[model samples]
Target: MARKKIVFVIVEGPSDQDALELLLNKIFDRDRVFVHVTYGDITSRAGNTPANILKKVQAEVGKYAKNNHFEKSHFKEVIHIIDTDGTYVSEDRVIEDETVGKTIYSPDSITARDKQSIVERNLSKRKNVDKLQATPLIWGKIPYSVYYMSCNLDHVLYNKQNSSDEEKENDSFEFARKYKSDTDGFKRFISESDFSVGGDYQSSWEYIKEGKHSLERHTNLGLCFPDSER
Candidate 1:
């Protein structure tokens, strides 16, 4: 039998991977599914530039391939998922709150102890996301796409945007468990949810950029798994 090619999924954090890893594997049964957790938001991290974003992705994919001794050709496609994190919101929507230690993302505003940090982070993240969206290939070969979960995976999946770390893990674990044996149900949950964005890929990206919509419950993840059933 021929070895199964890979469908590499790039995600922002462990929680994101924890939530969707099993479901994705079930959905892409014919292909090996690998979820590469970025640990942090790569786009908003310091020293990451729009110019080198794809290279960063290349490095991640390369690490996986190298350890497995699998060539790049072993992959079928790359699907990158990122949290919008209110990145497209206006500056005024980033409100400074003395009591808020970590940034709190609401539907219309981002409340942070350090508002400027959020503002600057949003600007840089938006630029890098645009760069990613504009690029159709990773490392000049693999087919690639970037999808959004705004203001983040927590918000879109659980309707809880400001969850603590413990809550996040519990929520993700439960969500994964709920749909682990019901991948089709998971597909319907994502595609038919109120937060699901309509239209083609490009238009979905465009939709997330308007006003404070990026801070709301919205996702284009359905675009990744058309005809998902086996």
Candidate 2:
């Protein structure tokens, strides 16, 4: 019998994989779902550009394939899930404050100790995300797509704009338990909730990148499901 192909999902953290892995597995019941945790936002990583991001993703996929003795044909698609992080906001909107030790995300603005650095990171991230959205294939063999959770996965799921590590893990665990046996219910929440962006894939991307939408609660993940489910 032929093996089911892989739905390789790339995410930014273990919590992300944990929160959605079970539900994603249920959604793609006939195929395998493997979520790759990137640890940090790859789009904002140092030295990452539009062109090299492709190579970076390919490297991650290749590493997995080699480890599993899987060939390129084993993959059905590479779906990247990342935080929007208000990456498209204007430089003026990035505020600098000394009291805060780390970056803070809000629907209308981002605050950090270093405003210029935040602005620069946003600029770089915006470019890379735009590039990835335009690239339909990666490694010349895998169908690739990227989705956003603005200002991040935690926000979209837990409505927590910014959370401590302990808080994040707790929230993610609770969320997972909530829908562990209800994949269809999970699907509806993402597709029909107020936070769910109402549009096709490309249009959702377009909407998030506009104004402060990237920092708001919005997701286009419904498009990743099968057409029948959608």
Output the TM-score of candidate 1.
Answer: 0.96
Clashes of 2: 0
lDDT of 1 by residue, 1-230 (tens): 98898999999889889999989998888899999998998888898889888888789989888998989889999999999999999999999989977887789899999988888888899999999998888866899999999989999999998999899999999999889889889998898888998678888989999999999999999889947320
Show the colliding residue pairs in model 2.
none
Instruction: For candidate 2, write residues 136-227 as lDDT tens digits.
Output: 89877789998889899999999998899888888889999999998889999988999998667788888998888988899998878875
Model 2, residue 43: what's the lDDT? 94
After superposition, candidate 2 runs with Cα above 4 Å error: 228-230
Q: How high a TM-score does candidate 2 get?
A: 0.97
CA lDDT, every model vs. true structure: 0.90, 0.89
